[model samples]
Target: MKLQDHSASLSEVNQSVDTTVVHKSGWRKILAFFGPAYLVSVGYMDPGNWATDLAGGSKYGYTLLWVLLMSNLMALLLQSLSARLGIVRGRDLAQANRETYPAPVNFVLYILAEIAIAATDLAEVLGMAIGIQLLTGLPLMWGVGLTVLDTFLLLLLQRYGIRKMEAFIITLVAIVGISFFVELVLARPPMGEVVTGFIPSLPDDTALYIAIGIIGATVMPHNLYLHSALVQTRKIKKTNEGIRHALKINFLDTTIALNLAFFVNAAILILAATVFYKAGHTEIADLHEAHRMLEPLLGTRLAPILFAVALIAAGQSSTVTGTLAGQIVMEGYLRLRINPWLRRLITRLVAIIPALIVIWVSGEEKIGQLLVFSQVLLSLQLGFAVIPLIHFVSDKHTMGAFAIKPIVKAGAWLISTVLVYLNIRMVWSEASEFISGNNPWWIDGLIILVGLAFISLLVITIIYPWLSRYRMERSARMHPTKVTLGSLEAPSYKRIAMALDFSQNDEKIIANALAQGRPDTEYILIHIVESASARYFGKEADDFETRKDQEQLDTYLALLAGRNINAKGVLGYRHRAKEIVRIVKAHDADLLVLGGHGHKGIKDWIYGETVNYVRHYVHIPVLVVQ
Candidate 1:
């Protein structure tokens, strides 16, 4: 229920760090706000961005540079809003949505956010693996396996403190920047053409698709969650002046960091443009192709080496933050906690399995396409994160005096609308193309069905808030003054049933049931024998199993009688869950008490769990005593 309880531990790690600088007004004080944005900027220039930028530049020769610039501008605005939300409201985007939205809305948003994170991680994992493959001679699968171990090593650095981790990330970012800068100089792109490329232009449909990829890869969804939470790590005072100052300083940090990301992205495009496109190597859309061609085209081996090093740096850095984002999303949305290592492993495996499959089946050539597809998937889930962010920040109630300016709110809405439109357009374009391809009729039908389903989900996501508001208003109007029982009375269970497995834990279950039941309560002790004889013999097996269970039930009844508990016993032949539900309903029982061994792992799965089944089938509340 508390804010901290739902916030990610990564953000909580260095929370309230150095809060005593409110009176200071120098650049030294502003330095305290620099780390979070750099951490976020890593997402902007990750290896996924590399694939898109490389493709855009080599294939179209800087014509799609406008897309990267536009996406960065969008990133800057959204990330600033994300940081403002955390600073002004003291809640991350996930926590804000969780507190503001209804359960169903929150549940849907949580699912979308998770999908976005997984998609983001999918790109990061592949990027890191490809970087590994490029740097070393290892297979792509081996490189992916290596990434899992390397990520754990990087995460262990967090134990040194968040600042150290931030410093490490900045160091990697610097490496990427310097590597690209060096490549830019070696490639020697024409300034006039580069400037022309900056002007917004799309040559054709292929350019539009690649431009969308650039946007998707640049303005990531997970970074929004990550930045919002990361800003909370700082210790700013909870005052209007303090918040205003924090926002201004954080904006500067975001601007500087993201511009650096822009430079890195642009440098990637410029390198590809000058080195590949100008040299008539228009087919160099793939990262590996670009890497191989850089050496021969640029007439220097260092270019490819620097490219690979920068890639590995970008991939490694992004992987660390990707893991952090996974943890943040999981904890924020689901309010569930697992060991950080375990959570990372689960997410990594989810990504790794598919990456390995693609590598094995499709080979290394498909990695670039997979990376681009992952980014587009992130784009699909972007609206779910973006709309809620704009809504929360624009609302007077949520933001109070710190609510976004009218112009800013309008701009945010414009951006959200554009993103939503682009996503729908992309989906339609892709679906139409697929349907028109050489696929079978049934496959076309399936594609159409999936597109309709996706559109339906999008419509629901957009309209859920309105539906919730209307439902609440309708309920209020219909109910008027709701009546309630305000008495502190214990609930009575007149007809109670206890399920016994005849285990050693049965006594504890019986004791617990007695503790809750009144003296006059009727308790039915039931046990079902899952007799193997029922498969081989019919009536004889049923009678034999019934008699055996009856003796056990009689013994339980005698035990209950000795304790002065009014009770009866029943025995059934097979189908434990069915018989238990039948007895509960037949007796009109209010509650069911069951003995639970709390079995786990394989044994729990294979032997089945009776209490779970009964709880699902019956309306009565079933309590399991472990």
Candidate 2:
């Protein structure tokens, strides 16, 4: 089996682009490797990071700048490992885990990965909403509702192609960088204090808590999944020399992009330290309050405007990448593919629902706390992703000649150990406070039960490699079934069923089906007029839609006629999947052929389940050509 053939589809964006440096040299060669790191960098300066930076700077002045610096260094190291894993192994982190671990272990890791993505999305959603609330006088809940529209933005940009989308993301990152640069200049932070802030120090428990949040938000788990896949989008030769060149260029890309992210994060903390901490307004932790106070503190309108603009840009860029990460995780771990738009909607809604509830019930007062807690949740899930990445990239069996050197391996392990320790300490502190504080007995019991379960799962994950090895050995000894030559010599397909949505992809579907068609084989083309949309309008509207659908089907039939293929078009109203299955059964189709657009995220949940349903209901061999 070819492992490269099973690479996640998310990396197919720019797969055709040649990243080899045949004639190119210096900066020009480096430019080809620029995109993936910027995409990863978006997570570093997202709203969750913003909330922590603001809280740290305001409450403790520039004391926590060392944490930001430390976190960025860790991010730089981890992100490099992630990219190397993809480039060397031709597999994303999630896919690697799925292939390496046992079913039960993989399932637990999948759950943790999804939770990390959701937590990351929650921060983005809240940040965008708060940015909107700052620029306009809208309520927090309304602003959150508006964020759903970003799904449409992603859909629009994606249609233009991956290069275009990368350019757009780069522009957003530029906006954020320039916005913070201007703010940094306006704030004019003390050079002496800023330099001193770089020295490591933690004043108290609050500082430690916020410091952990910074690390969690900065070294995002999804970015590890995302970067690994994103690196594969560029075409690199599989030779040892080509791999080394690519790794070097990628290291440069990671360093440059993450330093830029560091500047943005540092500027946020410095701005807070200068304006709020110096003025004795150290309690300005809320995003809205930070935005509102900026104008008065700087005594200029551009200060606040720039602040809000940067905030929105950060949030928007992160959410776009966040959506892609969600799709990669789902496809990588579950081997389940859905429409990209639907996948985006599902993940966005998952994040948005919780945010909307918090806004409506607890109000914006709780948002700051919620953002911090979300990062902490991300911190909890970080080990599951990071540990596996380190293990794979360092393993000679997996990486071959490209496996990490001993020095690099030692540093990576050290970073992972520090992160794991921080996360455990944060959880322990939170649990201690919860148990000590006044609360209901049931609530305390619930906390204890949840903590126990988490510990149990952690233990299982630790021992999973041994379990996987045992299972592999046991399975290796089992006998396999064999097929006879007569069965292999049967006819390819007697009858085939094709489903069409009458979209631009319909022709592609028809072309693919024709490729499989024989003179004796029959083909049934299907179109379903959805009942819900028909009911939204009246019978006249439904009739009009049916007429349009029929016209499109006729064009398909005409194409089939020209090819001299035995084919007929079938139309039905109301249910799509059931109708397609019924037509397939009625025609006695030996094979079902359909066009898969690979719609995912939010769109998958809403209307992209048709193919899934057909696959489950139909007993025949199904050929889904994407």
Candidate 3:
């Protein structure tokens, strides 16, 4: 017993030590990690950050540059943890947290994540309107009306590849970079103040809040989720050398993007200090103000033009990353495979409608303030999300070979504590000031309920670490859903509808499943050319099959089988594997016998669908008959 305990303790200690060296830090090869790093960087350059950065600089000038500098470095360090988690542990934060966390913790993370995405969408809409106003000389209202075009463009872009969309994003970043650079040079006031801006300090009701906003805007919670998952897409070899190279390139890409962001962030502040503060403009309450203000001083009518174009670029780029990140978060954590376009539409619609409503009721200035208010709420959401990321990444089990060092962990905790404190204090101050100054009893109720709920959640989040083992054991005790082959008794399922596309041996395998019959099992031999189904039917063929194809499919399967037959040849463009799962589950089949003839070319199997979508949605015992 003593020896076993000692061994267990040593094993745990070994595990703890291993995570430090987990990333296997090397850099001779950095090309592999570029794609995901670029995608992740979009979040850094998102329009929300621009809203805050622009506001920060215009409101407080170079004073808040420190925050931008600090936060970018912070984001770089934290985001690197995400990349290491994927490369070393072979799981993104979502997948890792799903396994490492309890039900309650996982649920909290998911809810916060979804909320963050929604909040970010709010700014993207504003950015879009700003862009339209820049390009076409339309009102914010009309500009917003036109942003639906962005969604259509996004959908069309997807037909090519995610990389093409990424390229477009780089173009946006470049435009943003150049625009900011020109503004910085044009507004050049004092080289000394700009240099001093890099040094951190607390500067009154001015840049301080805006600086925090810049920090908040940059290290978005969703991008962390997005980055972790995106790394797997590159198909990097699991070897240490390959993994190190991937990390190096990822660091390079992220560093480049974020460093650019730092400059732009600084530029915004420097320009604001030089142009707005020196000019004695007390208010820069909206995007229009900033634009109009620039026109008079820059001595160019193109000032508003540059402003709107930058806003549009920032808006569109962020929207893509937001959609992709949301997709990653949902799909990774909840196993919910939502369509990207539809998902993007939902977020876009949600963002657009509220802006339209606000514009219809109030005006551009009010709407823009509302966007800031939404961002404040986002600050709260982001506060909660950061805690878990910090907690999980610092854990030995989760980190495997890349756990944070003690100094780093301490610093992270300190930053997190201050963030939470600021958020709570701000919330209380806002609720009290708003409620006492002008609001009613419902505000009281809302404050009480929300505060209590947050407290309850915090308590649960704290206590969860202790209860996890017990809860895990309890979960383990529950019986799994009964999934058995040869259980569904049917006389007519011998008619096989084979989901056939990428499987050449599909016929051979279907024949084998027919020949190697489970006496009690009902067999639905299905050859589903889903693409063909869609082509011929001109609509989705859900076991909603055409009679001729069904009859012909039934006859073909009936020719090979020895039992009851009810086969259908359905055509649809749905994923073939998922289609099979849905069909088998809907019919309550005893067995889903897929034909894995394995006769396809290597390239075909690699590029095409072999296991179908089984890895994503299948829960039953799949019989891939040879």
Candidate 4:
């Protein structure tokens, strides 16, 4: 019994060790795999989300948390579809849609999506600048000035691979996540109220308005587009098991980061609720009020400072996502290649103009109104962007093996419809502030300018397709078949040579079939001995050789085995250079072709005997194929 007991105890100890090993290994796996999705999460936590959450919690307390849960699930389903499309096709979302849709429809959808990305980007810039003001006590204008510093940040992104950028953003996300985690615990938000918020009860008119803001904020279109495009940056191959893993990793990544986002969003709402709900705080505005009011409630130094730090992180990280999204939108839609720096500068300048103007003219009194307005526009534009993602992902011609199932399509459509309905409701509510206000002179002036700007931008966004089609038609009429890239090839050689280490005739057959321009060119086969004497000695003779001789033999054999081309090689040395020149002279050879790495410089040419002898002595037109 004692021996048996010892054995059982040892077995238990072994089991415990095995469990410990598994736990450690699992943690390593999780960390190693935790990329891509966190990058996607940045868009979810963009300044737009913070502004919406601030508005929601301040106005309705815990009444609209349900909007976030539903919106995030919707975001996940849509982004996943886009990501799956990318994985299967190995092309970004915009390009795939362009190929799949009719030219007119594709042009329209591309322009609308690009505008949506730009609008989303504008939110990121404003949010980052706001966070800068909160964190550094800079004036709003100076904080906006610091947005230019993002150009430097973009430099770091290019110098280091995007993996480094992902890490930097993930750290920022962790800081934001931890700040909210602490704030949520300290605020001691009512569990019962939080639960009820998710139950979807009808609120008063104020509650419904706040609810719309929350939904709009949570469901930005660019996040779907960014996630879908970003997944292709990783080394996801187009194999079945590999694709399945990519999908799984994307989901896990999105879930982890978005779950943190959900908490961060809820924390902002809960903080606002705890500090300002129904306290007769009718006109509290700006991140300043958010901080100062919360200071008295959640202690002084940590909570408010953390709030600012989180805002800064959210805004800065989002700028990177916004920049990349802008690049994709331009490349995929406009087919115009501009410097990334120029693109970012243009976006920042335009986006910050409104926010800067708001802070200047209306002061903090209207920032709340501005956040709601921006978010509602974002919600409205998202449908235009997301509906096509669903359509493209479901199209059998496009997605092929990875076409979204019927149920997923149904869910995506339902989500898009609900969001469209919410945006319409929100836009109607927001339009009232500009149109129906009691103020007289400045109100009318502000209303006219803002309305014109809003309508003009919206009209441009909607009518871009017609404009694009007109331009395309006009351009086609003006020019025809403008050849692109390397069209200056001489007539395809009747005979071609492929240099081989161990290649077979299979490639020669294909290359021969694929040879362009001249199909009936004479094919010549030739092999060279190391020296003219080697032809008499056979393969097993004395191998005293010259540089030109060795080169001629290899080049000749390759030319023989490769594509059908009229070319041959000969064996000779000492006068070998003279001999090859003599052969070219004798055959009246039109061209000599040599295969190589992309190097044709004097450095590679002079060091190797074959290249050295062939290049230096031969006078015929020599073509180098890389």
- The models' CA-based lDDT, in order, is 0.80, 0.85, 0.65, 0.63
Model 1 agreement with the true structure over 1-626: per-residue lDDT tens digits: 12234333355473646644657667668887779999999998888888888888889997888888888999999999999987886667777666556677678778777777777778778877777778886888888888788655654665566788899999999999999999988888889888888788878877877888888888888899888888888887778898888999999999999999999999998888898888888866678888888898889989988988998889888877877777777666666665556777777888888888988899889988888888888888888888878877876765788899999988998988889888888888988988889998999999889778667766766666545543323221123466787897989888788888887878887887777788899988877777787534533575566567778888888877898889998765557788889888888888889977765444544777677578778887888887
Candidate 4, residues 1-626, lDDT tens digits: the string is 01121111111111111111334575554454456678777777777787778777777777778788887787778767877766665555655445444566667666666666666666776677777777777877788777887876675564455567788988988988888888777777777777777877656766666666666677766666666666666553457766776677767877877787788887887777766774645444356677777777666677887888888888888888777777666555545546556877887777778877888998856765776666666676676677667766776754576788899888887987786666656555676765786778888787668656544544443445334432322221123458567768566555433222223543543353235325555433223443566655544445665444457455654764575544444433333334445555555555554444433333333434354456556665555544
TM-score, candidate number 2: 0.83
Query: Candidates ranked by lDDT, best first?
Result: 2, 1, 3, 4
Measured against the true structure, the TM-scores of the candidates, in listed sequence, are: 0.73, 0.83, 0.74, 0.66
The reply for model 2, stretches above 4 Å from the true place, is 1-14, 21-28, 438-445, 466-493, 496-584, 591-626
- Tens-place lDDT digits, model 3, residues 1-626: 01121111111112221212335554422443455676677667666766676677666667677787788887787787677665665555665556656767788878887888888888888877876776778888887767666666665555445556667878888898898777766766688877787777876744545655676677777777777666655556557666676677767777886788777666766777788877877466466677778888778876667777777777888887788777666655665655456778887888888888888888776865766665665767665556656766676764555677899888877776766776776667666766686667787888889887876776665455546642222221224468567767653433333444334566666666566454543455554544456545544453444444456565666664544543444433445565666766666654455655454333443455456455345555456666
lDDT computed for candidate 2: 0.85
What order do candidates take by TM-score, descending? Answer: 2, 3, 1, 4
Candidate 1 Cα errors over 4 Å, as ranges: 1-11, 22-25, 437-446, 463-626
Weakest 10 consecutive residues of candidate 4 by summed lDDT: 1-10
Error of 3 at 474 (Å): 11
Task: Give candidate 1's whole-model lDDT.
Answer: 0.80
Worst 10 residues of 2 by lDDT: 470-479
The superposed Cα distance between candidate 2 and the true structure at residue 519, in angstroms, equals: 5.9
**Judged by TM-score relative to the true structure, which candidate is superior, 2 or 3?**
2
Off by over 4 Å in 3: 1-29, 155-162, 239-245, 438-442, 466-493, 498-626
Expressed as tens digits, the lDDT of each residue in 1-626 for candidate 2 is 11222344474573645677589876776787779899899999999999999999999999999999999999999999999998887778888887777788788889999999999999999999999888997888889889888888888777666777889999999999999999988999989999889899999898998998989999999999999988888888889998998999999999999999999999999999999999999877689889889999899999999988998999999988998898788878877766666888888899999998888899889999899889988988888888888878877865888899999999988988898888878788889888999999999999989888777766665566545442322221123466455656545788888898878888788778777867788888888776566644523455667778889889888987897888888886666777789889988888888877787655765775677778878888888989
2 or 4, which is superior by lDDT? 2
